[model samples]
Structures are given as C-alpha cells and as structure tokens.
Target: MKITNVEFVISAVRPDQYPVDALPEFALAGRSNVGKSSLINRMINRKGLARTSAQPGKTQQLNYYRVNDQVYLVDFPGYGYAKVSKVQRQQFGQMIETFLNDREPLRMVLLIIDIRHEPSKDDILMYDWLKHYEIPVCVVTTKADKIPRSKWDKHVKMIKTSLGFHPADRHVLFSSETGLGRDELWALINTTIEEAKAEAAEAHEAEEAEETAEVSLEK
Candidate 1:
C-alpha cells in the first residue's frame, strides 16, 4: 500500500478513545524490542512514524495511525519487557486484552518475534490467545538480515514449531531495515480486508432477512 497521507490519531489507553471512523485496522503484536515500531515506519515509508528505542517497553498504549484515508494501522505495545515492574506489566496485559477482545474493527494481527532466538513463553501465549479468539494472524520473524541465507529456513521452522503454528498460519521472515516481506504483507492485508467486507455484507443480509420474516408473520 502506498501511503499518501499519514497522521497520528490517538494514544488510546481506553477503548472509547479509539478512532470512531469505520476503517479496517491491521495491528502489530509482539514482545518488547521485537522491531514492531521499525516495521510500521518501514511500511508507511516514514522515518519515525512509530518511534524506536534502545529501551524496551516504550509503547504502553494503543497507537493509531490513519493511512491514505482508507484504513487504520495500529501499533500495539509489545508485551514481554523484562525490566517492567510487576504493576506495570499487569497494566499492560489488561490494555492488550481489552484491545484484542473488545475492538471490533481489527482485521488481522501481525505477531512479531526475534529471528535469532526461540519463541519466548510470552510469544507462545500471545499466539494461543489469538488462536482461542479465532483471530487471523501473520507471524513475522524480524531481523532476518542478521542471519545467513542458508540458515533462514532453519530459524523459521524453529519459530513455527516453538509456537505450535500450523501450516495454515505461516511465518514471514521480515527485515524492517531491508524492507523484506513488505509486498507479501501488503497482499495479506488486502486479502484480509476483502474477507472482512464479505463477512459484513453477509451479516447485513442475514439481519434484513430476519426482519422481513418477522413482518410477514405479523401480517
């Protein structure tokens, strides 16, 4: 997607603060330092749209971005920051859960993880939670340029297996610095939007049909 316009909509600590416009949203989820902010900047063709840091857990709220006046791209706070205090960690968990479970405009989630290490326990749980909700997900293995080309397949397999990801849900080896997997992700987002549109249409038709039946029975 060519982002013609980009703007910060809000930092939503509460769900009510989310953008009221009915635009499809693609969210990025991951552990701290998983390169999500960098990925968003790369996607939007902006230098610092999402912000970066050597410090982990900088994003504590749902960051919203309006793209090309068509759709919303959300940068969710990464979950597994080691240095976070217990109280802060718990608060982060609540925020994440509220956005995932209650937010209806979310179309798909891109779960980011480091390519060099095994998927952490928090990563596994995040994946499982999305699964339980039947949410469509695309796993992104970041910092792929750090590894040799020969070792790419091996690391991808390790991540999939560690997270118990099925063949149906594949992982993309992403490099924000190199723009790896950018086209593939765009295609995925397009497909998700089409699917969501079809579902919404079907639901609207179903509701109309029920109303018609009620009217005829009352006559």
Candidate 2:
C-alpha cells in the first residue's frame, strides 16, 4: 500500500468493461453523499482523483481506480438518492447485484455509513445482502471528525445495532477530512486479500488431492 501510481481506469456499466488484469478489487458501497469518493481520494493521498460530486446519484457506473497498480477500488453507484427514478434505481440495483454476485476479482467490499446518524434502511439492506452472499466486508463509518471523541463509541454501537452487524465483521471509524482510520483500512484490505489467497490455495490443494486419490483408485 505504498503511495505510487494511481490511475482512473474506467467507468464500467457491464462486466465486459471491467478490467482484465485480474487484480484483487475492493468495491466501495454506500448511500449518496456518504463520502465514498472522498474516502477513495483520501486513501490514494490525492486531492481530486476521485471526484466529489455535489449531486447525489451522479455516478451511475462502476468507477474503477487502480491504486499503486496493484488493486482496484471499484466505486459502485450510491444508493438511496431520492431524485432518481424508480426505473433507474431498479437498473442500478440489478447492475450492483450482478457485480457483487459474479465478479471473481472482487476480494472484499467496504460499506460506508455516516457516523453521526443511525444506519439507514438502505444501509441495512446492503449489509444484509452482503452477509447473505457471505461476501467479505468491512463496514466503514465515515465523518468521525464531526463527532466528539467521547460519543464515537455510542454512534458506533447504534450503527452496529441498526445494521445487525456481525461481531466477526470488521468496522472501522473513518474521517476523510482528517485521515483517520486510513492506514487501518488499508491494512484491513491487504489482510483480506491475503486471507482470500490462502483460502483459494487451500481449495486448489484439496482438489488436487482428491484427483490424486481418484487416479490411484483407477490404477
């Protein structure tokens, strides 16, 4: 996670447009105006790499950003924007669901929420979907700088309660403005990638062992 080359790869609306590099990707998901772009920018140490839009639901595509040429941060379209038409929202949901369910390179997802408020209905639904899929996730509560330190624990508890967050799931308090939890988030991402690789390796070994046993029996 050293600071190096950061590039805006593509705005992909379909899997065909997704990057073919096979790099492990961390998908960022959250409601509109929840600071997903700002968190990406902060992680890359860039001021405006990920554009912070004043308009909610402005990003209708999966914006892929390559960090250090190693991992891609896939920013999904922010949900819960009231101005969007029902049809458009349905389309977005299908697009997101397809990626979450089918994307092979997706290692984990970072679901962002505001620290000062209870988790919205949209947030809870997203969390539930991820859990149902057994997708690796890290819940990021942003805007921690706006809240006082003493009350941070209280808000975190409220968020966990509202989302019914699993105790095993990782939760990081973040502040894009202050760089809080940036390092921790990066560490968590790297750890997730490593764990996924280990799991895949174990599965491959098991498959090979099974094949060997079958061959021996045939012999």
Candidate 1 lDDT over 1-219, as tens digits, reads: 777899988998987899998899989999988888899888889998788988988998888988888788888887877788889899888988888888889988899999999999999999999999998889999999999989999999889989999678856778998999987887788888898899999999999999999999999
lDDT of 1: 0.88
Listing every candidate in turn, what is its Cα RMSD in Å to the true structure after a full C-alpha superposition? Answer: 1.3, 1.2
Best candidate (score: TM-score): 2
Candidate 2: lDDT of 204? 100
lDDT of each: 0.88, 0.95
Each candidate's clash count: 0, 0
lDDT of 1 at 85: 88
Looking at candidate 1, the ten consecutive residues that score lowest on lDDT are 166-175
| CA displacement after TM-score superposition, residue 51 of candidate 1 (Å) | 0.5
Worst 10 residues of 2 by lDDT: 188-197
Query: Against the hidden reference, what TM-scores do the models get?
Result: 0.95, 0.96
Runs in model 1 lying further than 4 Å from the true structure: none
